[model samples]
Target: MSNLSKLESQSIFLLREAYRTFRRIGMPWSMGKDSNVLLWLAQKAFCGRIPFPVLHIDTTYEFPEMLEFRAWAQKHYGLQLIVKINEEAIARGVGYETHDPVTVTHELKTVALQQALAEYQWDALITGIRRDEDPTRAKERYFSPRSSEGEWNYKDQPPEFWNQFALPPKGAGGHVRVQPLLDWTEYDVWLYIRREKIPIPPLYFARNGKRFRSIGCRPITHPVPSTASTVDEIIAELYSTRTPERAGRAQDHHERNAMQKLRAKGFL
Candidate 1:
């Protein structure tokens, strides 16, 4: 079997297990390549029908194309997409223009997600986090348990030897974080997208001699000068590029522990 097929089978198995174990569950959709691929896998896992709501925590500063693509995908794929925005934060003028990217992300994305979970009574959350994305995420389990405050204690993560995931302790706020694509890498995601013929946002393609290596808000997201406009070209470029994927993400470059700090406080 192909590597993509193997990854798909593993993710399908994990999705089914999470569905059977959790009561109230949802998946985050950042309108990015990873989450979009996860959405596709969810439909495949459920036989062309996704069982859980797809959540998108809107910070109100996302690229306009991202929102448009998200809506189009929801309609085209028949997805039950729930858009959760930080209304209060926006009303209070919280954004990248004024505050630092890290703080803004905390208030508008992380804290916003926590509030949405509480409001929706979500017992579990499915994410597209990959171990290869960063050092901290590299330590996560397939099924990660968080405190009531949504803090991840990586030091006490459950063991998953031989695909046996230790169930989280009962009565833990009926909430857990599920990661099915934790083993997949950046290359795997692109290859899958290519093989599956999935349509991604046009911003990934070169425009005016620049292409966004990573998608984020306009103010904080910077694009590198690249001539690759096609998926195959992008894959080739990635093979030759020495920069990390998150190198252009302002928040991630803010500090040594910026991502870890944001994630520890419930950032996705």
Candidate 2:
């Protein structure tokens, strides 16, 4: 089998395993290329009907195109979307405009997600985070567990060898962060999107010689110079490009340990 096919099979297996093992499961959709691929794989894994709700933690700072695509994809796929927002933070005027990137991210994304998980009582969250996306993420396991307070102890993570994954002990009283796409790279994601004819937000494609390689809130995410306007062109670009995928993310530049702190605090 082709490598991409093998990857797809493994992701499907992980998705199924998470669903079968957890009492309640949800998939967090960021409306980015990777999340879109994960969503597609979830539908395929469940015979064109995803069983869990798709969560979107809207910080009210996302790019307009992202919000539009979120609405479009929801209708197009008939998704069970649950949009969560930390209205309390917004009311307190916590945003990029007033606070630093890290504070805004923590307040809007991390806190909002915690609220959603508490409100929904999800035992497992199917996330689209890939190890190749960030160095902090490279330490993740396929069935990574978080504390009851939603903190990830990366240094004490369980081992996964061969195709065996170690689940958290029974009655561990914590949520599992199932990363089905943990092994996929940026190039693999683009290739899968092309192969599956998946619909992604147009922001990924270059416009005026600039395109967002990794999308986030518009205030902090910048575009890189590129001429790759189509999926095929993007695939070709990935073959020769030396740019770090998240170079456009301003939060990474804030400090060396920024992402590690965020992930430890459950900022996926």
Q: Give the Å error, residue 136, model 2.
A: 0.6
lDDT tens readout by residue for model 1, 1-268: 9988999999989999999998889899888889888988998899899988989888888898998898899898888888888888888888877889899989989888888888888888999999988888998999988878888877888888998877787455646889999999998999999999988898889989889877877788999888989999989988888878877789998977999898888887
At residue 123, give the lDDT of candidate 2. Answer: 86
Highest TM-score model number: 2
Off by over 4 Å in 1: none
* lDDT of every predicted structure (CA atoms): 0.87, 0.92
Put down candidate 2 lDDT per residue, 65-169, tens digits, no spaces: 999999999999899999999999999999998999998999999999989888999889999999998899999999998987888999998889896988875
Candidate 1: Cα lDDT at 167: 74
Clashes of 1: 1
Model 1 local distance difference test score: 0.87
